[model samples]
Target: MFSKSKCFVGGQIWSQTTRRITKWLKEVKSSTIRETQLQPTCSSPVYCYGPLLHTVQTAEPKLFKDSKTFVDMRMIHSQSETLDTFNKLMEKTEGKPSHEELKQFVNKNFESGNELENATLSDWKENPKFLEKIKDPVLRQFASDLNQIWPGLARQIRPHVIENPTQYSIEPVPNKFVVPGGRFMEPYYWDSYWIISGLLICEMPDTARGVIENFLWFVEKYGFVPNGGRVYYAERSQPPLLASMVDLYIKYTNDTKWLKDNIDTLEKELKYWLNVHTVDVNGNTLLRYYAPSAGPRPESYREDLETAKGNQALYTELKSGAESGWDFSSRWFADTDGSLNSIQVTNIVPVDLNAFYCGAVEHISNFYSILGNDKKSAEWKNIRDEFRESIYKVLWSEEDGIWFDVNITTGEKRKQFYPSNVSPLWTKCIGQNQNMVEVGDRVAKYVSQSDMFYYPGGIPTSSNRAGEQWDFPNAWPPLQGIMVEGLANSESQMAQQLSFNLTERWVRSNLRGFRDTNEMFEKYDCEVPGRYGGGGEYVVQSGFGWTNGVILEMLNAHGDELTADED
Candidate 1:
């Protein structure tokens, strides 16, 4: 549903569309999801309220009243002021009595249908237990630091707190997991992939296992993992990386017994992704960022509504970008305006989503082969081959020598230069002789020297100077880590060199930031390595999990090969 307002796309006035409420059916994990469409009878346009599962408003708090750990965290998010007061109160409250008193105070403020202005859920499990020994100073204690944060960031959900979006079913997830810190107090889908890398390096297999278990629980209960472990995020999913997370955990722990027990769930989850999120392009299906519901996101409502201007399609596309996890990046925009109004995310088919899916297929195929299920293994391998064949046909740009996203509607390739252009190569989708070799070659050529990409510190999200937080000048650890890993897999000397350089640059910033601030940040200012990043809807985040994860991972992966910075 789009507003009656005429929108613009590619310099053409978009056709006016109206909201049509239609009941839809879906197979959610334990609960059946029933979608209720809203149609307006009045002069105002239809403003449908998307159903949220496992939300405080939907579920009864009294159901979990008997649980000792169920401390209604939603109350703290009633308003920004209440959240500020809660954070301050938390500093004074330390014991059981204090916890109970704080709980009552929040309960007093809690009212049904009360505006939850912004639902930024954070769950920091009690205090951290310090690691007593550090054996390697050359590594600069990143692994040790992450290991310390692992326990303190653990959170769990009780069985009764389910928010099933439909009338169909309800599945329960009761497991412990780690958060990515800042306002993200809950587990995120793709963040777990990099976080598990550091967790394995730190030899904290249990915490890593807990993270995967929580996600598998989500797949079993919700049919797929949400963007993050929040009710408001149920509309869409982030990049599908649960298979990679499981691969990391099992590779490090030799936990074949657990893998054997969970292989059924793995296969089912893979089907959930392919069947549910797949886009049909000329009878060949590829993955894309998708959100089932249409509305301004509840979390960023004010901003979303303001940009949407009552256009339902634009609203859904913007929400799709949020699902991509590089939310609000200029990569999703049409041109240099860099305005949110320029976003039309649902139309593009991303390269990384396809590559990552290929990687997931490989993981599943290998897992099946390991089980000696040759027929099933071959079946999955064929599926991988079919999906891989569609990559270049749909996304590769010959003139640009880069893999770009496809505008799904117009069948046109978007040639915006993006770090994700390197993603297909990261998944080892190219080699010496294949046509994809050109893609690898181009990525190698630019990644080594692009000023827009390679900063003094590390690779920023994009070359775009857009003031958005996910754009230039902000170096995220996960992007840097992926570049290092991908380039390391390349056969070219330039690619290999770029791999080491990216790691060195990122490490310089990470080490310097830790030295100056005494804590890891969620993102870095590559121009001035120690400067905190800004320009997001919220302030700069601290105690950042993925930063700590990738820093430790890069150190472990390239530490011995590169010269160690002087301690």
Candidate 2:
């Protein structure tokens, strides 16, 4: 079920208001479960849940520092044989096997390293025409290096995985796809959007098309895409960017026939979110990120267990936070201390999630329009209009000069300085009545006046220095892409300049970090230009997918103006 490649290893609380919160959460979970039950789910024997998984992930001293390592191991024999051996060992030791004994059993039965092998890209081009736009040799070389990273991060499931499905956690895809390197071996949900964009820029549309097709395969098999290409992530999903990826692919390829073929699947995926993840806010329906699952994440079993401290509700919240793609951020914490235990991701109606929905529906509407389905096109357009209206009524804050995530539980706005607060601008979900120019100008000024500009390297994910990777001092590539795209697309000149400035800083930091370390990091220390980011569950990753994508996107957008001369 795995390929032979390289090996890299990688919430909670209560209250009296807790009673009402708990009750609401239960109702929400019940409703979501019922909705999900109507659809076919691609369940795995060992990845999502099972005795073998539980024993290994929770084993004392841990089989691997990163719990994902154990789940990712391919079995040497059939899964039933492996499980029988494990159960026999447990019975022999009366369910109290020594850590070493368990370790030995695992080593004997499973592959010793990561499940995904490095896949070479047949479409990789050494010099893309996009790079010729860069006048500066230093910047062009850096951009070239980023382009070269594509093949190394490409991965495909082993053929044995298809023959022996139960022997692995990885969901098999028919084609090779790029991964966000350094322990993130499988293809992720939203990361593919940027990866595909970068691939197209590198003149690798075939590779980009393959990744999109993999996601389409997921929607067909699972009725929705999982958070990543693993069974453990089946119950959860990251940002709803499948349609966005489709949009990007069409722009680069102009493949209307492909859109016609896959439009139904896209609608099915969108309906999954609309049916399962939507919530009510004062009678208006909006979307929120929710992962209706139990137990600590198999990938992060130990860390989630210790943080939750046996609280199942807390575990669920942690998983939901992870589903938001900003796991362990202060933006999700309910307390002022920024404690992991205080995370309340379910209560909050995230601005970015809703904005993404808005964008997705609009794209779907356009897809239908292109396919000459005027009736369905009009229907999706109406849905988009209604959703945009709800977002404007519920999430926008004229007083604060930006949109905010509203707490569905309390009906109060979370008026924090999060990069996501500007997502509506990015998604262009600023309501049908609002003037784009006026709104863009105001939002641009708001951003210009915020603490984001204080970071010389790039925009921090949030103003809070919560010691989480998604918090202060850490600037992630995806967040940078969001802010830059949001502002650059605006009618406000100041906003466009701010976008360019942020773009320049991010590209410089990535370039400097690559120059110093000879690597492209997953996240960077926004406070230190050349340093890689550190915080959260594991060591900072390298050969990152989105990082390379964002930098290449920036280079493509502003290559003529950007210079590599010492600032």
Candidate 3:
């Protein structure tokens, strides 16, 4: 009876091995892992009993573990010899394979198996080896989904694809630039700034620099950094931050000459946004910037106005108010502008854009001073001050306790409470007394209240249960970081509390998910704790760069200031 049982188990192992090897060989091309002429001896039961029984006995877990230890020890002894062989091959190949060759090699070597197909939950629990192999595959699929929905998330969150020097040569894809969320993100200029902050936290200064240089290169090659570099990316220009990035790069590398060379390109980008994109309305001459009529679609509330044609009309109308330097025509569209013609209407002034322009001017002035252009420095300072004064005079709402976007055509405030109203405080462009206190109070109120802007993760980009929820329950890392830094600058007690709250929430969220399943998700659903917010409508990403970067920076700043002393 014992002999019969051993033969039964042996037959099972042999059949499994034969099926696995056949399937693997069939899938691979003839060029790789050629099949040997040797065949299994199924005809002779005696031969099967001899080797197969011995194989099953030796493959027992206890014996296999000991065998593996011996094999590993042997490998350690031959490590030097193996390394030498590898080095010789590398030497013979003259360093690295070409891009095409590397791609072919990867294609040949990488194989996806059917281990995950129709895999049941119980299967994962029972099969440790199968579960282990599918872990990375599952993550990769999630990442693919993230990249498709939120392209920016991919760029900001995905792990850096590293090329081994010996195996592959890295090359840029033609007519391509790194998109924020994913592989083919619709390029946006300001978005990269936040993305860079995350990169900095990863101690990836080189990658951070490459991302910055890509923007600078775009500015040099195209005269202006279009909302993004691609044709589809021409919707709106974001706040100019090339000078700030240059400053940041200098901070990391102390490469003054690099700053010097890029200074000209930076200056041009500044001028393009400040002079060309902005307009002077009613003799105020305050700095005004334009947002492409195309706003973020997935984030916006109204589905009807999210179309390209609708946004185009909005853009055309906005251009007409180019003279006012303050356009608010687009603000009311989602609220009350019922006509499709209303989509073309522009003249709406955006508070965040103006505030960002203030920051750009301040950075440019600082850059000029660094370059010893004192005269230009003074000029920029004067311009900055004038812009600041106009912002206070025209945009401030004493009753609302916040700044607002004004209608350039109508010359009235939009009366909508949004986060952009408080964003200017981060720029330090507002006054110290009443305006600061009021803005601080508003920010504190929004952050502390759970049903409003506050969420489990962090302060939402816009407020929930408000007129518009742009700042509601969704927390973006860049915005959250800026707000934390801004509040700290103002010395608001709320800043510390909010920072701690956000940091703890993020850390806990990551730990819970990773500890439970050994996986990291993209974004926590701010409205619903413990659930993943469906990624932006592009791709599901992993290692979300900005999220990881911001979390690190925020945690680092938990008991300290968010910005350097220079601010």
Candidate 4:
């Protein structure tokens, strides 16, 4: 009664099932299908009634002896039924796969998994516990929204209790904490440090500690943490934030023993910077930190010969004095003296690095004092004070009203307009007079300017539209967030306005970008208003740890006033 085509399809299904059974029988040589108990309620229903019934209802025991026949027949019928249903669906859709429609179907079935639906901002706001932990409603709202964007970010950021743990070290891949970005981000060691601040603010101390421990593990294992754990990532690291991360960890844990236990390792890291990374020429220590002399290239090593081809020139070349793998290394070359030298010259001395190093020395001194190592503490203090003096004298440019990095040997100030100049303010190293005011004014000007630093969303990395702008037009949440705090410290009214303007722009841009594309990109091309750029390899969304974390914390720090919060 069936049509020729139906018979042909059924015959094909039967043949396929027969072949499968034959293969199975060959594999299970002596064993019968009966030995392998098949469930009655299999995936398909047609198997119960079709060819299987015929094979099982046979009178001869020999026919029943090889249960493989029954099993194969059942599989044939089940497959045919499935094929028929698929064919019917295809007919209805005119042979289209219906991928989108199917996705909708699956999503509907798993509607509960939707982040916004599950953890609505309204729900977070209503939670008294969350409100108590994060007193600011704006911050709470921001966190709730971020949760909607990336659900596990907040939980992954919280600090946890480590009991009976291994030595205080960094694990490339922690059993408990997995950075959402994964192993691909091995080269971004210092970047992770900046991202950790957001986690700390979220009360995710465990996650923060785990990240620190992992870095320490890296330091203990490899002398310095490379840009990443992969072999290819061994060459370069991002900006060094080891000391800052240590400070944060100490603040949260208050574990003096942890500091004491790791002080030797920390000191070793510092020594590595001094002896290996920095070069001593004419009694002055010149920093040689970064390598390959190219700006923001994906590959850690230098791709070209002529040292800093483009925007990469904006960064300094610290040849010898990197304390951590994340510290900069100098480009390799032969000096005019015909001697192999690691060139420590950088795009600038970088206000941030100097400030961070100063802070590190101070922390080291404090730790030593606490440990009753007065001699060591005093030694470190003297070094710290000297570095502070150098930072002020060498990096400050009175003409520009901004503190810039100087080629320590040449004594020429790096004439670059970058956010790094704002970092010294964070360290409170800028003295009185109009120094703070001048720096604040410059930052304010950059914020208000439309063609350069100012964009629809936030401050850009660099202003030269033609030049490579790492921070230009692309408002990095971490930098913006830090500046907000730094501005508060300076108590500059203009700085406050700049911070508020940038924050509001970011929120607006984020909303607009998300609306257009249902994800938060790594960096937004603020110049274009809604476009996102600068993502390499990965599908640059989802695991935006720093952006989500920093923004939430910054908003919280600002409290009800998203602009001017002294605290």
Candidate 5:
């Protein structure tokens, strides 16, 4: 039912593209999912988003703290047998099970901790040269500890998972990779970009290459990377970073043969984004975060059901918000009420998403040039040029002095102070005619005027204190990386200093959090240094992959200059 619509951009007719709509249920109803019965097929609705999943997630008093605990657990019996037993149990309990009953059922029916095995990276070095660069003794020791965390975070899928994939939600990949740790036992999509960067910094190119190879496998099989390594995530992707990961991999390893071997898979990943996620804004093409899947996410099932309250549109929007990796953020909401019900993620084109795509394509072009394929290089270069122009034309707010996420329906700028506004600079998504020095000055001025420097922990995700994890008080690792790296890329000295100042605050916060808890966190409260973030579906998690990566990257960039002295 998708139809292309013509776009009028600056008095010129642009190419046609499909729009994301609120018909998730309609698509699901028409999909090939089995209408009834639970089976071992990954595509079976029963396993992914049907009665069994729903019943387990919504059990009275909740047997597990996180709903994801149930879905990720391996079934001890066959799916069909498990469903049949569950049906009989439900009938015996009149379809309403107590916490104890559910606990016993789960204990008897499933086994936990069998999906992934801890992998030891053979290339892990005890002391990389980055440690020598750090002038501060305390900070250097902290960085060393973070380096040690790599072994604990590295994971590989178990043989049973590959053999009996349908018994678990985790996706089976061919190579050993790093997981984000804690309850996140599977390799995620966007998190890997930072993880890969950290791996290269640690001088583990083979480990990094293995991680990228897994992503290539995902692109070959799913036509795009899933949000994470799980069957439930098959419906959507996080931000596109596969190409950027590969680009960094090549820079570190100089593995041209590897790049030449897998360049087609990289191209296929980019095409999936271009063909599916593009939107026409006044004839200009831009990308937005989207999740075409129906039903509550298997990981956050209970919370999504409660938030959506039977509204299928909200369910789709919630899923899209998850796909944005800023799950439950005020950035995606349509209203100022600060409620999840107001989320409308599919209605807006995000600046960071487009910048990531543009940057990725630019790398693709560079990668081709490296392989001496001038024709393909020029083709992607031309596409990259067009994308940058479109971003400037459609997302740049000249008066506001920054890029903004625009609403797709009304084509209006979402003027706000999310760190993502300056993401174009990090991705080098500027227009061809723009002066780098002036752009840098303007971005620096924007940060100063926004009072983003007021926070001691790091740059807050947004100016809004909307009680969501992505709003005020909370600073994410990736957003901090985006802001610091983006501003530093500017030719203006002020921007570079601003980037360093941010690095100091962010590193100090990571150090403080690690010293306080002996663990790294997923997000931190910028307003309160050393405090982990709050107000998400689950407790703020530790063993955070990207947080460690960003910290390591900052250490690599500013280790010699960073100090632990408060003064």
Candidate 6:
């Protein structure tokens, strides 16, 4: 059974409005879990309901300080006093949403992946020209199809009316947006990075801007983008790549005004990181994936409530790991169990999280320098300098010869290899970061391996072939783009070669899959060709937004020169 949340009863009153309140609950007996794929609903207020996390904007939003529970449709302060409320409110409200209503959502008959394939909030429309006369037929056809897919994926909502600027909520974003496909009906935080890439290539710049502006609306209220564009996702964020997203957006449109206007919001996002996500670890202000509270994630309540039982504290960590977007990877697990039950995610200080922070801070520092904030630029640059050094000193595992997520409790390294190791190179902080040029050399070892990291389709989520979606055999677009671009940026020739190889293989697989299935997928099985990827929380999904985006990018970079026209 799929994980479904919110067992809610109707008619709850809040802020002088007769509203429907949702709650996430857990009632587990024996070790078995049962859930429904749910009958399809024609319309929802937000893209999704978690199976229960969907959101509709509130007219008069109330600011909440509890970061433990729901903060959707609210404002959160970036500073400590306001930040304090978020931390506290979150503690009280998490998993308080009704879980009883879930059965009502279940279909009288079972639902399948094919049933949910077209379940987006928006209808597919044609806005841009589809390529017809491209040299490589395979590349041309896939690009044309992804361009067609964007319209069906797009959504538009009204601006949030939050009572204050300090509150954060995951209400439906205030502008037009596109979801990441399949059950992901909301605009996700990190997925926007790749989606924007496809939007630019598709000549749909306006839609891309709408997506960014929608996120800016969130930054305006909550100080950072929520993990997804739903009010419920405000608890934990995805990868910190907004700076990179802005860079990509500007690269295509050169929107200076948007950057200038949002510079302050960008800085506030930095403060969100420094004030909330950062910790003074052994005198260094490094970042960590801190879950909101020691409660079950509203979306994954029953599964979490059962695993790591008798240890709610550890449960919070596990939820935080899911927030990291490498949800259910071996790196976060404690035992040999390959399932989600083995997750102990909060225990580690992720190298990628800090590496992303390194890039974000540096990107902000440079952007401010361009905006003529000299003092501010130097101040942020100093922060980046300290952070870059800390990543090397604290995160780079000398014994493993690559970065590892360090266990916070024992000060021991995770000893597991993940795509997290290549993140520093993506930030271009590898050789230049504390002059650790050898760090690139050490990382290239595993990246260069064929039977391991160098799969024919792309780098599998990681070298470990566990059943998790983020694990090996299943490779997603975000990691492919991240690893390839990071490699291209590296001074090492090996890094550049690997970048070309990664892009070529992934793009090739996308072409073959499009030819076979007439569909683009959320991920691909690296070990198989023209087949759907498997072993995630859900079935192999189609109409995937990021996969379409990154595939366009890879082909654009290497299609004519490197592609051999397998057709």
Per-residue alpha-carbon lDDT of candidate 4 for residues 146-225, written as tens digits (9 for 90 to 100) = 65443343222112113211111112233233233422222246556656665555555665666677666666765655
lDDT of each: 0.63, 0.82, 0.45, 0.47, 0.83, 0.63
As for lDDT, the candidate ahead, 3 or 6, is 6
RMSD of each: 12.1, 8.1, 25.5, 23.3, 5.5, 13.6
TM-score of each: 0.75, 0.92, 0.57, 0.60, 0.91, 0.74
Winning model by lDDT = 5
- Native-vs-model 3 lDDT? 0.45
- Supply every candidate's count of residue pairs whose N, Cα or C atoms clash at under 3 angstroms: 13, 2, 45, 50, 2, 42
Writing each residue's lDDT as its tens digit, candidate 6 over 1-567 gives: 112322222122111111111111111111121223212111221221222232111111211122122323232223245334423433554723223222222222112222112233232335344353345765676667777778777755433323332233335455677888766766798888899888877776777777888878888866677777655466567888888777777777777777898888777676666555555445455677765443455455444555666365555566577689877777677753456666666556788888888898888888887777787787677667777767777677766667767766577666665666788888866423444345556677656653656667777777677887788888878888888877777666776777887777778788888888888888888888656778755577788888888877776666565554543
Report how far off residue 118 is in candidate 6 (Å). Answer: 12
Residues 15-47, candidate 3, lDDT per residue (tens digit)? 112121122112211111111321221121111
Residue range 191-278, candidate 1, lDDT tens digits: 8887777677776677678778888877776677878765556667898888888888878777778988988788776766665556
Model 2 Cα displacement at 112 (Å)? 3.2
Candidate 1 local distance difference test against the native? 0.63
Model 5, 473-499: lDDT tens digits are: 899999999999999998789999889
Off by over 4 Å in 5: 1-42, 91-101
